[model samples]
Target: MRPLDLLLAVGVMLIWGYNFVIAKYGLAELPPLLFMALRFGLVALLLVPFVRMPRGRWRDVLILAVMLGLTHFSLMFVGLAHVDAAVAAIVIQVQVPASAFLAMVLFGDRIGWRRALGMAVAIGGVAILAGEPRHSSALWAIGLIVTAAIVWAGANIQMKRMTDLDPSTINGWMSLLAAPMLLCASLLIEDGQWQAVTRASGWAWMAVAFQAVIVVIFSYAIWYRLLRTYSVNQTMPYTLLVPVFGVLSGVLFLDEPASWSLLLGGIATLIGVGIIILRRPKAVEAQAQVT
Candidate 1:
């Protein structure tokens, strides 16, 4: 990563980190599914004109949209409405381990003992965090977010199959496919969609715009550019900064308390994820062969 690219990576981290707080604000004013519908609908509307139709993988694209755009975001935003933003940020890191585990099961990807240990430590940390008395009421919400992470991991697996497609085009088509599906889900499962839209404040609308345009479109455009320019190992590590920024922003802006459990568990989880992510490829392959 060049110095400029590093700065861009950090900028994307910041945008994503603050997104939890932004989503919280938007959820305050609207139902979770409806808010998600608006976010994806706006992104689709803006990018569909410029992005070309995906070639010969419409089913995969729709599946990815359902897994990532509809299922993941709907559960996540609803969980955010019920839990603290800082906790949401920390808990969502489980996606890393979840993805690794899924690969092991689904594709026979072999992870070494060290990586296995990292997954255990990460799961343990999430368990400890959830067991905290302060967050007892949010256990269900935590489960929802963790399940969302699993869905996200599944989407990542789907993404690997679509590696030839441009990231922006994938996002654009996924959003286009997801918008109506999510809106229909909102109509069936949630009340007050129309009322929420009618009554949404300017700040809430701004939150939606920020999520749609900045977080999804702009940051992802730059992210794909960086991935093209740099090795995955060089750029992937910076993502650890997301939860750091998320927790800090929640504390600073949302006045969310960071308890001892949160700090310890979050640190453990991040460290574990870091180890798994930074491990050498040859080591992983060697372990797999031995196993």
Candidate 2:
């Protein structure tokens, strides 16, 4: 990666890191689901013109929209609403392992014993994190967040299948498709919708705009470009920083607790997931040939 690309990746890390804080703050003014709906709606509207639905990928786009956009974000925001952002950040990092496991089962992608052990360790960390309820509904909320991760991984795998399309096109069109359903769900589930809209402060409005435009649209477009230019394993590890940022941002902004279990579990999860993440696709293929 060039210095500029590295910088862009770092910038993405910071934005996503602080995303938890932004969402937490934004949710203070609006319902979690509604906030997601509005955020994606703004993203969809902005990208509506430039986004073209790719050939041979309408179904993939819809699947990605549901997996990546609606199911992932909705569960994530709801989980964030219930749990501490920092821990939520750490817990969500388990998505890497979730993806690895799903790949093994769904696609017959190779998973060596080392990666399997890492998965076990990662799940164990989650268990430790969940055992402590005083830390903020760790059990139920973690389930929601993990579900978001699995869905996201499935979406990513789907994205990888659409070889002709770029990531920007996928990101834009998926957001547009997912927005309306999110909006309708928000309306049905959350109250004080119009009031939240009317009473939102300038900063809150800016938060929403920042999330929609910067985080969801522009940054993701840049990320997908990076994914195309680089290897997935190389790019995927960079996302590990997102949760790191999430922890830091939540601590600084939300004053979320920095407990021992969170730190320990986070470290264990990172180390475990890193084992799987740092492995090369070629190595996996080689290992598969042997097995």
Candidate 3:
């Protein structure tokens, strides 16, 4: 990667890493589903006019809308509401191994012993993290986040299948389809949404806008451009920095306590994910880029 592109990649990671803390702030004021609805709605409003249709792939785009936009994000924010941001960051890396396993099972993608061991180590680290005493009360939340990761991994497989679509187009249509569905879900399942939206603090609304505009639209535009400009190996490795920044931001901004178990398990988890990401075949690495 060129130095300029390297800087851009790192910028995206920083924005995304701090996004956990930002989402935590927004979720404080709005219901999880409602917050997600607003975020996607804003993205759709901003980008739908600019994004071209995926031509023959509308059905797949809708599936991505439901899977990535609705299911994964809803569970993620709800889980974040219940658990510490640092934990959410570390645990979400499970998507790496989860995607690898899914590729093997669903697509008959072969995994070498090294990748297999990486998957085991990553899962084991998550188990250790979940078993920590400080996080006992959050086991349900952790479970939700892990399930979200699986859903996210599934969406990645879908993305891999539709490799011809532009990333921005996919994202735009997904946001367009998802906004209404998520709003309907929020209306059905959550209470006091009107009150929450009306009473939301300025900072909370700013967080929502930031997530939509900066994290979803701007960061992804840069990310896709980098992927187009450089090899996946050059760009994908920088994503490991996301969890690192997440942990650090959680500690600094939220004053979240990181127990020894969290630190150790997080390191082990990231290491395992790094192994899977860095050492996997190029084909597998390309699939992992969808995350």
Candidate 1 collision pairs: none
Error of 1 at 1 (Å): 2.4
What's the count of clashing pairs in each model shown? 0, 2, 0
**Residues 197-257, model 1: lDDT tens digits:** 9999998999999999999999988887877777667777888999989999899999999
* lDDT (Cα, 0-100) at 9 in candidate 3: 95
Residue 271 error, candidate 1, Å: 0.8
Please give the TM-score that candidate 3 achieves against the real structure.
Answer: 0.96
**lDDT tens digits by residue: candidate 3, 1-291:** 778888899999999999999999998899999999999999988888987995678899998998999999999999999998889999999999998899889888888998888888888888889999878888999999999999999998888877777777877789999999999999999999999998999989999999999998899889988877677788889999999999999999999987888888888898889888888786676654553
Sorted on TM-score, best first, the list reads 3, 1, 2
- Angstrom error of the Cα, residue 190, model 1: value is 0.9
What is the lDDT, from 0 to 100, of the residue 192 in candidate 1? 81
Worst 10 residues of 3 by lDDT: 282-291
* Residue 18's lDDT in candidate 3: 96
The parts of candidate 2 lying over 4 Å away from their true place are 136-138, 283-291
Best by lDDT: 3
Indicate whether candidate 2 or candidate 3 has the larger TM-score.
3
Worst 10 residues of 2 by lDDT: 282-291
